[model samples]
Target chain A: MNQRNESVEMDNQLAEFSDRILNDEETARAEGLTGELADLEKTVLRLNAAASQEALNEAQSKRMLLRLKERMRREQEEKAPFWKRFFNPQFGFLVVAAALTLFLVVNAPAVVNPDLSGTATSKSGVYVAAGVLTLFMAAYWLMRKK
Target chain B: MQNNSPHQQEISDEVLIRRYLNGEVEVFDLLYYRHLPKVHKRVRYVIPPNDVEDVTQEVFIAAVKALPSFRGDAKFSTWLRTLTNHKVAEYYRKRSRKQEPQIAALTETLAHPDNLSFHSVEERIYLQRALMSLPENYREILLLRFAEGLQFNEIAEAGNRNLEATKSLFRRAVTALRHCLEE
Candidate 1:
């Protein structure tokens, strides 16, 4: 047989031998293995031995599950919608900053134009603050996308 | 009605996925526990011990994020296995970026195996090093047969190869492994 054909034949034999050894070990042993086939059988056995040792015990599994759940919870919180995330304690600073910005904008007319009309300035000031916040958010989003 | 009973082992993974999509989120825990052992085994085969848990967690976390998009074209187990492989690859990629070795050094002291004997841990690491040194296809075939516990025919189907080709690959992989161990 040519080299390729011989290699193919050996492969078929190895696969067959592996099936028999795994499915019916006693029968495979009774039939006896030799040559490269014997060496392949030993290799298969060694791989199996290594695999059998890789099981995660109950305690390990439980500990891993706990850690996984904790991480997933954190992940979920991080991926929460913007509005929902804004309520998180870590965003308290942002909330305060927003409130301060609103206050500054509401009182800016009184500071800049001491004789300016009161009610309309405050209302327009509120709109101005909202508009600035929207523009800031849009710019932030664009930057992130870029 | 979707059964949410914790003891309902007969419910299929697909069913749990459907229920999870239908807002029965708790069913995911069932899927997680059901597949954890096999997924953990596969990850353990390739990853270092200290990082195995982290990598396994990353696999499931990716699964969770991607679960909503899963179309059920393939079996959940198969999908999870693929995800685990991706996460392991990503782990190595990040490690490589950080200038870490691919696999732990052969002479590096191994952490004590949780339940394994000292000799077994050494043997396992030695075998792991040998496996790592193999070409990707060779390593993959061996892992499919051993770590994934796939039969030769099943591996052939999974890899989209003819039975003969798959067997031939298996032979070459084993021979290569033997050579690696001999060295």
Candidate 2:
């Protein structure tokens, strides 16, 4: 036969072979071919996997372990203790400065004498002390209303 | 209605991906198991037998890693095939730079069994080698039809061509396969 005719014959044979393998009536009826097909497939896959190249090795495993450890360490770092949350020096400084500023704003007038001990107390200090007292009184009244 | 209700198994790729992003890694595995065979077959279509499994693993790994970034615009399978194409191109790129002796070395690695049926693994390997000998476009259509078991319409969609074009391409691919098998 010519090369072309031989190829045509091979194609036909391939198709017929597939049909026979799939349509094994005796095996299908006796043993459930679908299940057999699945099992056979599993075997084929297992064989392929066994003979196939492996993705694992000591180097790759060590790299993966290192990655896992690093990620865990990162997660642990994320979940820091409550005290450690304040470990940020800049943020702590900002917080302390804010707290001191707030304390000075609230209590500075209390230290100043609104009623002057002597004539050394200027009129401006007296006015400033009065404004602070008035603000505090208003804030206290609003809180009481709430 | 109760009997016909679709379970999580029946849920579409979009929903499954949504579940995956919602913190279910196992859902990705389910999707992987569902799609791996087709991906494996497609990889088998393009490359030689020795490299097919490696390509398959690469495809799966890429897919799994990129799942979180999937934007739900394209169909999951289409996106996956696109990724497959990219890997195939990369393989060819790496392959083209290598010397022929290295490729020839792969021939020895092919297990040639005697007394083989046409349906046997040996024959399949032979057929795969023949398919790989064809041009990239011809190989793609043959792989889509035979290995991947996609319809002509699906091939057209994957090829981004019309149905008639895809049909003619597939016929030509089969004809080419016949010629290759003869050679």
Highest TM-score against the true fold, candidate: 1
lDDT of each: 0.76, 0.57
| DockQ scores of the candidates | 0.31, 0.02
Give the CA lDDT, 0 to 100, for residue B92 in model 2: 72
Assign candidate 2 its CAPRI class.
Answer: incorrect
Question: Which candidate's DockQ is highest?
Answer: 1
Cα lDDT tens digits, model 1, B1-183, are 123465688888999999999999887878888888778778777776556778889999899889999999999998998899899889888877764543452223344345556676666666777887899889988887777778888999999998988998999999999888779
- Assess the local accuracy of residue A121 in candidate 2 as a C-alpha lDDT between 0 and 100: 39
For candidate 2, write residues B115-164 as lDDT tens digits: 22323444445455566677879876755655556755777887899866
The residue pairs found clashing in candidate 2 are none
TM-score of chain B of each: 0.80, 0.72
Kindly list the interface RMSD, in angstroms, of each predicted candidate in the order they appear.
4.3, 11.8
Candidate 1 residue B155 C-alpha distance from true site, Å = 1.7
Task: Compute the lDDT of residue B58 as modeled in candidate 2.
Answer: 68
Model 1 chain A weakest 10-residue run by lDDT: A22-31
